[model samples]
Target: MPSLHEFATWEPLLRLLRTGNAGNLAVPGGHVAGQISHYGWSLPLQRRIPRPGQAAQVEDVQDEFDAVQRVQGALADIGADTISFTAEISPTGRSVLHLISPGPAVEPGIGGPHPGSLILVEDSVPEPWRRLPDPVPGAVPAPSVDLASLERTLRERVPGAVGATEAEIAATEARLGVALPDELKVLYRVTRARWEDWGEDHAVAERVFTAVGCELFPLDDLYIADASSRPCPWRFGAREAVVTPPDAAVQGLVGSPGWIAFGDNGGGDRIAVDLTPGPRGHTGQIIMLSHEDNIGAGLLADSLSQLVLEGRGPGRRGRHGDGPPAVARVNIRSLDSVRAAAHAGLEVLSLGVWEGAPFSLAPVTGLPRLRTLTAYPGTLADPMEIAELTVLEFLELGPEDWRVLVDAGAVPRGLSAAAIEVHGSRHPLQVVALANELLTLWDRPPITRTIVEGHLEPGV
Candidate 1:
């Protein structure tokens, strides 16, 4: 097990990088950067052209594969997740490499050269994720619900199926801390749907799927699909808002504590019995949480009985309607300016890359609901204007913008989370310095960096 700091651990990878970026390394201030994990690498190496009349294969890039695998083996030995490196090679082939470890509390960047997010506040989550369904006082089961008919239908559909005992049902309720909906209990009473009951027979499982109208979970596998169950990174999650409309039959939420997940839609979506109904919804209506979406559910059926019998609902509609837009983006393609997106309803304001002049934040300074502001590096006319946004809970800014805020002692004390957005080839150490300053204000742990110095011989 070679040490990560040893020159041998990184020599092969560095040699490949030096060769691939030789042209750039000959010039002043030129460097090559990329990330590597146990799975693969994202280096700036040139791809070899396959000979005519042949398709590309792994063997074509064998050199790159072997180089990355050597580094991965060292990483596995050292128990590190991933490493990002920046290497600058002089024309004489003297190289300096800086290896960066994503310290605890930082989310790794997804499939790119970008550094991942820095979590400022520990265990803090976005407001929408923390939102609970508003109580629906007048909600009741739909008129179409019939417990006796549902039980009788299931019994006839799958004859001789083993059912869950009353004690088992009670044990499940105690495990989840919530009572099973009457409709779900009835379905499980007809067939517990455990694999052991049906043995290795594929036809029995198919019959259960046909009878239940969805892939049913065994009694022991039932879980509450709470907001915590569906996790999202703070950068994207902060931009979402839960807005259940007046006419919506299902409450728009990240997840509901009342959502008792009982089955799947066969495409990885969770089918749950929503106990916390919307203003116009029944208490036991069936809804689905899409695996692709971060927020909100779609109404599936009025009840479990309706789902198993008719296999459809009145209409499949999202829980949220065209309420006042809560998130606004100001960039080249989005709203032209801040003023155009200003309103009391706005909660998330993102300033992206722009072709026009930098914009001021004055238009939205006093808006009561604004809580998140993410500005691309140099998009703000005055970064100091962020101080006026007194209630911001999540703030993401480029290194320079954050420096301005940190230097003036105005890095929004109310922020529950923050991120440093880096563009181009800025050093990770510089980003860590800015992030530490922000974290220090909140008394959070600082990001630690490990520097490994090594040199590569000049490529022939």
Candidate 2:
């Protein structure tokens, strides 16, 4: 057996072995194997045992599949838009590089995202080996992520997050007038910094879950730095519905920032994310309503949040790179709470309030760092106060808030780009003023803008 001093990381010594290859090498106990090459790690068969001798063949196929899925799921969970892998095993004695392969990248939408590419070779090689696989039609190389290094980087860069003790967590729930899902709490206890390369997958995953009409909630709130030692709050929610089909209508919710609605087919009109008695509002965090529900104030909030997160401008995160400083283009329902939260220095704030609720914009003071704000088509509490946010870059206002913008005299400072859906507003003049000057509104046609405000000058 190798001495403890000889090893570095745990689960070391990975290697791979082909199913039909007779070049078996004897390995010590600490080694692991991996199979790289022609066999495309059949994932469907994993988790099922075969009949004795056949068990090795089927189990190998399945074991490889399990490995691929395990890693793939992790990748997707973290938002790696794509990944793939091949299979192999470790040697018996050595612990490092025993069974491994060059995991490859797999693009989603093509027979699903492939797991990372890997190779299971014999345990004899002391030096790390890299062997290329023959080109398989559907096979793609997986993108590499130094997860450990990344974790270390996060630890180094971000300040440590203090977690809520059991009692404190309970007190927060009592004070907030809502009960948080355990999964979300877990996520909060961990960390919320968005992982590199995983944003797309996370977005896609949210879309998939939302498409099924399940209630979706942003999990960004629960992410904290003190999370390494504790269970992830988001995981608590995930555990409840892990067995639920990925496409099922009752998926667990995610509470991250940047809520996006991908494609058009919402699985009918099922409710996604349930915020019920939470801080956001009654619609249960961020949710997508049926077409009828879309007009609801909460629907507007969800839409606005989605819009602001998508547009190209100063505030949005933008595409992977060089696409533009994409602003979050949103179709919102209200701005009341967002206004307050903004003053709280919160860069990312959740929007929740079913559409059709009364509009009010309570002033949010002191949140100088607030960068983004979203709301649905509800009324405003104090519209004029919005101009005070000199640093505000992205502003998604509910329909009623347009009046407040027009009344404010000038376009809100620092708002170079924005997105909003002005539906069923009581004042057409306010809407016209918005379409004419401030926003690059999309849902309504520009021609309509001329007819409504053509009589009046661009301002009022």
Best model number under TM-score = 1
Q: How well does model 2 score by local distance difference test?
A: 0.32
Q: CA lDDT, every prediction?
A: 0.84, 0.32
Best by lDDT: 1
Model 2, 1-460: lDDT tens digits are: 3221122211121111222221333322211122222223322121446677663565555545554444444444544433222222233232222211112111111221121111111111101011111122332211222234433433343335233456755664564445554433442333332333134456644532332223222332222111121222120111111111222221212221112222122344322223321222322223343333211112322222232233211111111223211222212443343433333424433344554454343444445555555555554456666676566545556555655675656446555334444443123233334444442322212212111000111111
lDDT tens digits, residues 232-269, model 1?
Answer: 98888999988878898888888988999988888998
- For each candidate in turn, the TM-score is 0.91, 0.23
Model 2 regions more than 4 Å off: 1-345, 354-363, 425-433, 439-460
**Angstrom error at residue 382, model 1:** 0.9
What lDDT does candidate 2 reach at residue 49? 61
- Candidate RMSDs in Å, in order, are 2.6, 29.2
